[model samples]
Target: MKILLIDNASLTPVNSALCCEPKTGEFAKELQALGNEVTMYGQIVESENIHAFNIQENGINVVGHHRRKLKIFNYILLYLLIIPQIFKSDFIYIFYPSAFKYISILCFIFNKPYGLYVRGEMGLKNGVSSFIYKKAYKVFTVTDYFTTLINSLSKSNIAETIRPMINLNEKDIMPVNKKNISGIFKVLFLARLEEDKGVKEILYAIYKLKKMDYNLKLILVGDGGYKKEAMHIIDKLDISDFVELKGAIYDIDKVKNMYLDSNVYILPTYHEGFPRTLYEAMIFGTPIITTFVGGIPYLMRDKFNCVQIKVKSVESIVNALIYSINNHEKMLDYAKNAQTTVKPIINSTRLSHAEALHNAIHNI
Candidate 1:
């Protein structure tokens, strides 16, 4: 089947000697592997003398449309252009509801089948997304909480919950060390350095732990708009000796190494649709310490696969960290359990995009 993927994100050429962002690139590759002719339509900010369209790595075709100067106007123009293309495709898989709603009118007009995939929390009080939720054919979300939110917001009662597919192979999962590593416990916080991502809370927790003489090393990965603010918090707390902000790591192998070296993965995010980092941490057999927010609790069970802390509380996070360090064996058990829980769900061979596309196509 021919599938036209409309992505608002940037897409460079395959021969550009640059790798695309892992998550988006993985999904694109998956669609291509499924024998579907995948055409990616993404943003092109500046004017290029050469052609815009290019075949990316793994044989995926990408078309870059120009959007100069005016940001809102470009998006509006893209939305208008996308409507005509939607009628030509066999299936329409949209990423967010706002864009989905904008495109849904065309699908509704033409009597076409379209699926909405919500990647983050959508049902905030008085948000514009509530209207978009009501128009989708089938709503797909990454977590149970998001599924619940979609169901509550949808007036038509057409929502199906499906977990985001992670492309995990044997290489992704590190061998579990049954023997515990001694000395300072390594903690990893892998996400965008944003206030909502709980970077400040993690730093404060680290400070509290250090004062109590808990040997810990914190590695902060991923760069975001909040880097300066987060750095200021790190400096203000004076826990620079224990915490190291390794900004924007894109290499998959290096990310896995960070996970392999760490004893615990802490993500005290205030909100999320479903965090991919949690799954990445679990795949590497690292015990997780995260807040009970969004889809986290759905993927993890307290005292079973991970330890859940209260959101925005330094005290809670620190206490949880101390508990995890002292009870290292239990943490390891949880890590092992996490590996068990996530392995089957994210395994690429068993359930590929080919299968998902087949399912979507057959249903349509």
Candidate 2:
């Protein structure tokens, strides 16, 4: 089978180099390994019109197309180049709906089947998403929570929840040692520093904790559109010393260390589509404190594996944190169970996701 994969979020000429969407690239490698000839089309760096390279080990050919920045001529040329590729390919796998827009028309004209993979919450009910999802042979989702929503928005019941590809190996896993619940509790908040990601809510929770004179350190990682505002909140509250805002660390080892050094991981995000960070925290045996949004509820239990908090609720965040601090032993239990629960999914590597894609194509 010849598969044409469109993942604009990934770096072009895909290799072992790390990028924002490494797992998506790894999945492409896995598809090639599954005996499918895959040509991954992604955005090219500036000044490069188009380039193609091969990952010899995986037998995957990666093509980098010029990234158009709101230019009509560029879009016209891109469509001309991509339509022929669609005619030649046996199947199409598009990561985001935006990318789907580029190929859906060609696929329709050629009478070819394509799979739509929804990575995030499609916030608005737009015609493009509705039409492509409805026309696609199948819709793959990251979480079960979005299954119903996608069906309603797309007006199609072809949506199925599939596991996300996370880069986790045995080396990244920390040694399971005896639980130590005492000392200055290290609470980690790692995600985009955005309003919807609950950065302000995290700050408010920390402020409430500080008022009670709780001995805890909050480490905020990742940079985004709300960094300055988040910084303002921290300074206004005069809790800068208690909180450390380490803007986006790109090193994978550094990220793993952050998880290892922290006693708990808190993601008070307002929305998510089965975030990979939860899997990372769980694999490292860090207890999770997150909101009941997106596919999070499907991945975890309210009080069993990890404590669930209410979305956009600072009081809920504070209460969950207090519960974690007061009942350290119980938190450790959650951490241990979380690691155990996530093992099967994370350890399987590309087999699970690849098989689902393969079956979706063959059945359709």
Candidate 3:
């Protein structure tokens, strides 16, 4: 089987150095290991009409177009260049549904069937993405909410909810002996720094916790356009020392260690499909305090696996933080339950995505 992996999700500006999507590369590599020939459509910052070998070292062929400052003529030229590659493959698997809005039309013209994976929200700019979903062979979304939304919009029964398979290694997992979360508590927030992500609310929550005389350090990771705004909040609240904005740590090992080093993880996001960060934090046995939004409730229980906070509520965040701190033993229990809940689903290497892809392709 020849598989064409389309990773159209743009990386945050902070992740510019890394050329390949980690999950897509891992998924494609797994497919290739299963004896399928896989080719990736990479997202590179290029100036001219060009193609670069992105993951050739990993045994996957890549052909990509320049993403930054791309004009209408550039897209036209890129479409022409990529059309032949689409013709060469037996199946097309797209990472982002909106990306297929235009490419799916080309696939339709060439009589090629493609499967779309919805990571988060859709591009409903012209209401044509619904039409694209309708034409797709399969629609795989990370959350049940997305599956239902796509099925309703496309009027197609092909939508399936496949869990986001996190790629964790033996080295990435902290040993049981080293997994103690006692002493000066360190809270970690790993997500894109944006208004909707609830970064400002998190900062205020940290301030409240500090005022309560809790010895804790809040670390904010990842980057976006809202960095300055978030920084302003931290400075204005006079809790700069309590919060550390690490920006985006591109090093994979560093990210894994960041989770391991922290005692708690929080994502007060206004919206999310299924946060991969929570999954990682759970796998690392870090207690999570997140808002009840999207598919998060499907995985995290109110007091079973995590502390459920209300979306866009600073008071809720502060209360959850206090509760977690006060009930340290129960917090650890929730963290343990979280790790147990996620262990069965995470595939690390040969992800469940492989099985999902296989089923989607053969079931047709």
Candidate 4:
């Protein structure tokens, strides 16, 4: 089967070749490994570095298209370029809502079947979203909460929960009961450093921790638009020694090491559908400090398996960190609960997700 995956993620092309984001890129490789001809279409850097239209990336074929400055013109050109791929692919799967708009029209014009994969609920509340999801061949959402939201908002029982396609070795996963809270008080923040993700709040929280003379260290393991600003604040706050901005880690082993070493994982994002990082932290038996937003509420209750902090609140983040530190036994218990919650889903291989894709396409 020739499967075409579309995403709004930017791909940098040059001597480094085509860059695919880890989650989507790894999932595409899984599809290809399943004997399916998989090709991904993503945004290419609009620069002189433009090379071939398609490149083989980690056993998967990646097709990148350069973007136009004008937003309207960009979509027009994007649709024109993607029309050919629409016909070429046996099944079309799109991640992200922006690329989802009007692709339905192109699919209908070609009489091709297309599935929708929504990672978040950002643009899910409007009429346009309702119509699009209602018309989709299948809708794969992240959590049970989001699944219900999609069906309710669309007024159609079309959305279903899809397992986050993460491959964690069961044997390597630290048993939650064996989790240790006493150690180097290190915090891990492993997501894009965006304002919405609460990077600034976290930085301030670290500063507050320092003011109290706590020898806590923070490791930020992702980069985004706010990286420069985050760095500026780190320098401004004079907490550089306490913070390490690792910047967009691709090495799973290195990432696993960070998770294992950290006493707690924090994601004080203002919004989310369900972050896959939460599950990663859970597998490592690291206590989680996050806001109760998106799919988080469905899986985690406050002071249950995770510490729920107010969104965008530096005070909440600081207090949560302090709470995790002072209450070792309780935090360990929470980590254990989190591990039990995510174990089944985390243990499932990416093959399960790929096979589900196959099943959805073939059955549809």
Largest lDDT belongs to which candidate? 4
| Candidate 1 Cα errors over 4 Å, as ranges | 7-20, 42-58, 63-74, 97-101, 124-137, 144-163, 169-181, 347-349, 362-364
Q: Please give the lDDT score at residue 89 for candidate 2.
A: 87
- Model 3: worst 10 consecutive residues (lDDT sum): 45-54
Task: Give the TM-score of each candidate.
Answer: 0.80, 0.76, 0.79, 0.91
Over 1-364, each residue of candidate 4 has an lDDT whose tens digit, in order, gives 8988987566767675786666676677778877789888866774422233234647777766787889788778878888888888988888757664678767866888888888776777878777777777888888888789888877788788877767674555786533355555888999987889999999999999999988788999887778889999999999999999787776778888888888889999998889989988888888899999888899988888999999879999989999888997898899988877886665645336677777777644
Clashes (backbone N, CA, C under 3 Å), per candidate, total 0, 0, 0, 0
lDDT of 3 by residue, 1-364 (tens): 8888777654222223334546666787888877788887744553211122236667777776566465666667767777888989898887764443588788888989988877766463236778778888988888777788788888778888876756663335443213454677788999878899998888988898889888888999887768888888888999988988887775667887898888778999987779889878877778889997877887789899999999889999999988877787788788888877776566454337777787668643
Put down candidate 1 lDDT per residue, 53-157, tens digits, no spaces. 344645776556666478788778877777657766777766663433466556766777766677665453344566556755566677666767778876555
* Candidate-wise lDDT, in order: 0.72, 0.75, 0.75, 0.80
lDDT of 1 at 148: 77
Tens-place lDDT digits, model 2, residues 209-274: 999989999999887668889889999999998899887765668887888888889999887778
Kindly report which residue pairs in candidate 2 clash with one another.
none
Give model 2's TM-score versus the native structure: 0.76
Candidate 1, residue 154: how far the Cα is off, in Å: 5.8
Cα error of candidate 1 at position 123, Å? 2.2
